[model samples]
Target: MERKHFLKSLLVGAMSAPALLAACGKDDETVAPSTDSTSSGSCTVAPTETEGPFPTKVPASYVRSNIVDGKTGHPMTVKITIKNANNSCAVLSGALVDIWHCDAEGNYSEYGGTGMQATNYQSVHFLRGRQITDANGLVTFTSIFPGWYSGRATHIHVHIYSASGTSLKVTQIAFPEGTGSAVAAVNGYAKGMNGYTYNASDNVFSDGVTQELATVTGSTSAGFELAITLNVAV
Candidate 1:
């Protein structure tokens, strides 16, 4: 979704735009190997971006290694390795990573006063959580295929914090169009296929998404796996 939609979804009591266009998790079932890596010659830091407007400041109860929180859709396994850009992109362990995204219908949990979908969902917290990176600087989240809103492709929001709880980086991750197209064919995500914008036209990813796109694998039947190396300055 565009920045404006994010603001409207989180700021107002209701939104006039398409309900599915409104802006908006983790589990520890398994530790998937990192399918994405940075070569020795090219280990630049992931591009920093906004944290999106929908992030809640409420205390999160779902801070364990698993963050699925019972929400349902095509399963997605997200594994990200946090690295210190100042240290030649070496893995930086124990940093805190917070990730959140909309559900299959594009409505964000813990925040729904905007009348995008559920009204009583304002206090509900699903598909939003945090996890501390392991010794390998890896954190995994089990989530669902994210739904798309107007002006944006399928993506996820990430915020990395230092071990001292200081914010280090804010960025978004995108999925390849092919991945999105395939997921859209599924039951819940079909709505996202319409009016969906590609990466080149998305305001946040227009510059380029090579560094922000996750290396996604698997399928809608068995679920998908997304892995990426998030290099940040410590």
Candidate 2:
């Protein structure tokens, strides 16, 4: 879904820090922090300062597609909406967000390779890129459904950018669907069946994230809409 930063490029956009922070995507969308759960604000800003890789570059031809071989999305395309964390959160308009993920068969090209290494693609940036949020601090991309590996559920990696193209926060977002956790009940992974959704037991989305980042939704014809929330600890 995205890539890593080279030297952390941050080209501060023209929006004022506070005004820019006000327009981050968090406002209208779900998954806001507890204090702002019902509060609707753009939720766009990211961290402002960093030490290492900051605003990275978007990889070549990082547009949406099936896979490296041009595989089309199964039921529909994977639409990712990257918005500024929250206005005043620090005007991350020009911040770079890098993404990368696996194919429909749990295989990552540049990083993990295949087979035994299937679960560790973090070392590489396959479907990676650097997308700058608009005035609203939002960037959307169309991509294919990611497949699951042996030990991990389907997921996408995201790295947020701060002011001046500094790498502020680096985290990953994943989808969970399967029986037992409504994934199976909704997607019908129960009764000895497999589906795009995993369970509440998915490993990738497992650290203190109880329905935090991704909100799973299913469509009979559109496959799934794995809505995500990227909240930097800043």
Candidate 3:
């Protein structure tokens, strides 16, 4: 498959924090919760997944809560909590959490004009940011509900690291069902629900989504909220 081939090719150069500091840098539900891991008390270790083709090369520079970067779509607020699987699920405060995703039109910033993505957003950075986990082991980002791509479901890529910059995990958050309708509701997304791939068919999610699935709440009209707990061995 083209998507699988592309993913394999990009694996070597996936984003990392030590590269540079000058690089750039969600939705609720009309949907059901995919798994129980969203609960604050769940300690199941989150499944590590690929960071995908696009990642923020210089994550350290974009350390803000709002990663919208002027992109327009239904509003979304993403909350992620980090927990240590090796320590009785204790909150892993001070971990670095970095996230990036496609915009409402399924195009990623800082990348485009390639065989996989052709939108040409290489000049600007939007929908990408990094935040350090707070005392509560949580990092929140203000963003827009992501749109679908040809072979992947609606999702977000996350990279976690220790406080001292040691790499911990590279994973992703999968959206719940009913995400198609939410994508259709986006104003300028002409693709609508035409070529969307659901979690069941997604290469990264097909095996299972029990640990990576997120709990989404809210609606297209009022925007949405996503909350997920990620447990990693520290």
* TM-score, one value per model: 0.79, 0.55, 0.80
Indicate which candidate wins on lDDT.
3
Lowest lDDT 10-residue stretch of candidate 1: 25-34
lDDT for each residue of candidate 2 in 1-234, tens digit (9 for 90 to 100):
132332222234553322221111111123253222323563433322111221224443454333334543444333444443343233235555566665555555554443234355544444445566656445555555565544344556666655465655655555555443323433322223353334344433433343235665665355655555454423
Query: By the TM-score metric, which is better: model 1 or model 3?
Result: 3
Clashes of each: 6, 44, 3
* lDDT per residue (tens digit) for residues 1-234 in model 3: 001222444444653321211111111111122223435534556665656468787989899999999998889999999988767667889999999998878888988886667689998889999999999899999999997667777889899999999987777888877535443355236666765677777767777777788888777789989998887778
Per-residue error for 62 in candidate 3, Å, reads 0.7
Scored by lDDT, model 1 comes in at: 0.69
The segments of candidate 2 whose C-alpha lies over 4 angstroms from its true place after superposition are 1-69, 75-91, 112-115, 118-126, 176-203, 218-220
Residue 54 Cα positional deviation in candidate 2, in Å, after optimal superposition: 19
Report how far residue 148 has shifted in candidate 2, in Å: 0.5
Candidate 1, residue 120: how far the Cα is off, in Å: 4.8
TM-score of 1: 0.79
